[model samples]
Target: MKSRSASKITLTSYDDLLGGVATLEDVREVAIDELHSFTDHPFKVKDDEEMKELVESVKAQGILTALLVRPLKKGGYEIISGHRRKHAAELAGLKQVPVIVREMDKDSAVQAMVDSNLQRENILPSEKAFAYRMKMEAVKHQGVSGANSAKKVGKENKDSARQVYRYIRLTYLMNTLLKAVDENIIKLQIGVELSYLSIIEQEMVEEVHDSTGKYPSLEQAKQLRKHREEKSLTKEVIRLLIIGEPKKKTSITFKQDDIKKYFPPDYDEQKMRSIICQLLEEWSNQNH
Candidate 1:
C-alpha cells in the first residue's frame, strides 16, 4: 500500500486493475475514513463462525483478492462488492487493503455491485431475489430523477421498465419471509408463490416463523397455502398455527373386550375364519 495520499490514487483504467491492483504492503495501515462502503450490496446474513474462519484465512493467506471500489463525489471511494472481505480484513488487523478504483455514476455503481456479487456459480436464491430487487429500485431511482443521474454506456439506458417492475414485486413479502429470503433459506419462486395469498395469509406465514424456526418444507407450506386459497382459513387461524400450540399427540388404541361387541351371535369361530381367509385370497388372486 502506498502512503495515505489521495494524490497517488486515480481512476486510470478498469482493466489494468481488473485482475491486478497495487497492494499496500509498504503501508502498514490506512485510516478507515479514506474508504467508503457501498450502500447497495445485499448479502447481509452474517455467519459468525464463517467470519471467524475468514479472519483466520486472511491472517494466514493475506487478502488474496482486492476489494472493488469507485471514487465518491465527496472524497473517499465506495466499495462495490467485498464488504465482507473488507470487514474480515479489518478484523484480521489489515492496515491497508488492495482495491480497484474506477469511475462510474450512481445507477452503474448500483448495477455493478449487484452484477459482480450475483454472477458467482453458487449464488443463493434469496441473494438473487434481494439483488434483483435492489437493482430494480436503483433503476427506478434513476428513471424518476433524470438521464444525467444515471451513468451512460454506449447507448441510451435500454433496460426494460417492466422487467424492473417485476423485480420490485418482491418487496411485498412480510418481514420474516423477506429475511428468510435474504438468508437464502427460502426460494425466490416460493416467495412469489407465497405472495399470492391475502395479507392475512401473509401474516399467517409470518406467524409460522416461531414454530418452524426456519421456513417450512415446500409441501407443508403448500398445505397451509392451499387452506388459505380455499378461504377456509382466516388471519386469526393462520396466526394461531404460526404461533403454534403445546398440545401433545395421542395414539389410537382399542382393548380386546371392546372389539368383541361387533361380532354376530351366529358367527362361527374357526371354520368361518378359514372360509373368509380363502375368499379373501381368491379375491386378491383375481384382482392381480
Candidate 2:
C-alpha cells in the first residue's frame, strides 16, 4: 500500500498566514536603509533592557505589527511610528521590516507621531517637553480656531491643556538643566520656574551650584526668577540668593586624622583648634 502524500503549504506574509485579507496597497516589507526617522523625533531609542527584549522578540517570533510610515517626495519612507521597533529590527539583523504607508501633511504627521509614542511607559521629561512643543506648533499650523492650541493638544493626549503648556515651557531650559529635570535632580515644578530665566541667568545659577555644591530649593528658584525679572540678577546676587542666610547649627564634628593632617606633627589639640579658628575666620570674612 502506498502512503498518502502530505499536502504542501506555501507561507506568505504574516497577515496572509493569519487568514486576514491584505489591503495590498498600504503594507509591504521595505529595506531598512530606505526608512528614515521622523524629523525632530522626540522619543529616545535607547539600547536598554526594553530594547534588548524587543530585539529578542523580533529575532524569535518576528515583528507582529507593521510600522506606520509615509512616503517622502524625493524617495524612501519616513517613520511616523515604530521608531523603536525599527531600531529593534536592525539589531535583530533583519534586512527589511513590514510598514504601512500613509499620505500625511507635516501637521498630521507630527500629531500622529506624538500620539503613537505617548502611550509608551518610561517617557523622559525632555522627551515630553519637545514632543509637547512640536504638537502645539502642529496644532497651530492646522489653523485650529482658538489661541488655545495647547488645550487642543491636551485633549488628544488626555491631559489638561495647562499641563501641556507647562511641559512645553521646559523646552526653554539649557540642556544640562533639562537633563537634571529628567534625572529628578531638579523637580518638575522648580524646573518650570527656572525655565523662565534667560540663558545667561540660568548659566549663573549653574555656576552658583558648581561653586557652592547646592541646588536651589523651590522657594529659592522662585526668588531667583523674581530677581531676574527685576533686572538685578548678577552672579554675586545669584550666589548670595542660592546660599541664603546662615541657618542655626545642627551639629559639628571633625575627624582627628583630618585635623592632624592639616597641622604640624607636634601640634596639640589646642594648636589645631587655634589654626582651625583662624582659617574659618578668614573664610567667613572673605565670603561676607
Candidate 3:
C-alpha cells in the first residue's frame, strides 16, 4: 500500500523541509543520528541474517526508499515506516539517509505505523497481539467502535474480527508465557486459555512447567480456569492437574507375620485363616 505524506496537514513543525507538498515528492537527507525509533514499536528490529543482507544492500545501493517520518513534539522526527531501512543505513555508516517528512497526528501515526509494519512476512504472535490492540484503540479514538472497530483493523491486516481478538488475548499473558506462545511452546488455543488466568496463577503454571517439565494441556488449562479460586488451585494441585491423575493401585499385600499376631496360638493355620474371615465378616455385618 502507498504511504500517506505528512503534507496533507500542516507541515510547519519541520525545522528542515524540502517542500510543503507530497511526502513522496519531498524527500530529504535526514541525519541518521537524528531519526528516532517509533514510540512503542511492536515489531522487533533484529540483527539477523536478513539484516546482514539489508546492510550489504544499503552499503552498495544506498537507501532505495525514503523513510516516512513525522516531526515529534520534542523537535526530532519519529520514524513512521522504513525502520529496517534506517537501521540498515546506520549499520552501513551513512551520515544521512533519505526521508519523507509528513504531518501525522499520534492516532493516525499509530494506525499508519501498525499498518505499514503488518505488511511484513513474519510477525510474531505477540507483535500481532499488541499491534492489533494498538490499532484497535487508534480506531476507537477516531470514533470507530463496536464490531466495526475490529472489522476496520482486521480488514487492513487480512484477518477476521475473531482472529484479531484471539491475537490480542496474548497481550494479557506474562512475558515468559507470551514468549512461549510466540515460540510455539504453547499452542495458540492454550495460550488464549492461559490468558484468562490471573498473573499469579499463570506464574504458578509457569513454575509447574519449569519444575516438572510439563507443558499445560488444553484440558489442564481448562482445569486451571475451572478451579481458578486460589484456595482450590495450589501449586501442587496445579502440578497434579497438569500432569493428570495418578495411577490406581491394583493389589495390596500384607506380610504373614503382621497378621499372625492377631490369631490365637492354639489354632491351626487353616483354622486361623477361617476364623479371621469369619471375624471380619461379623465385624463388617455389625458396621454395615
- Against the true structure, candidate 3 reaches a TM-score of 0.78
Please give, for residues 1-288, the per-residue lDDT of candidate 1 as tens digits.
444443343333233324344444422223455787777456663658888998998898766555668878788878886677788888899767767666777776877787666545555545655666666556657674333323221022243444333334456677667767757677665666576677667776666666556455555556567777787777555544444566789986666456455566666567556765788899999999
TM-score ranking from best candidate downward: 3, 2, 1
Distance from true location, Cα of 218 in model 1, Å: 6.6
Q: Estimate the TM-score of every prediction.
A: 0.55, 0.77, 0.78
Q: For model 2, where is the 10-residue window of minimal lDDT?
A: 1-10
lDDT, candidate 2, 56-161, per-residue tens: 9989877766777889998999998789989999999998887777788888888878987887888898999899999888888888745489788888788898
Alpha-carbon runs more than 4 Å astray in model 2: 1-25, 145-147, 246-288
lDDT for each residue of candidate 3 in 174-248, tens digit (9 for 90 to 100)? 999999999999998899888988899899999989987887888888878778744577788788998877899
Winning candidate number (TM-score) = 3
The residue-level lDDT of candidate 3 at 273 comes to 78
Candidate scoring better on TM-score of 1 and 2: 2
Clash-forming residue pairs, model 1: 1-23, 1-24, 1-25, 29-95, 207-242, 208-242
Candidate 3: deviation at residue 46, Å?
A: 0.5
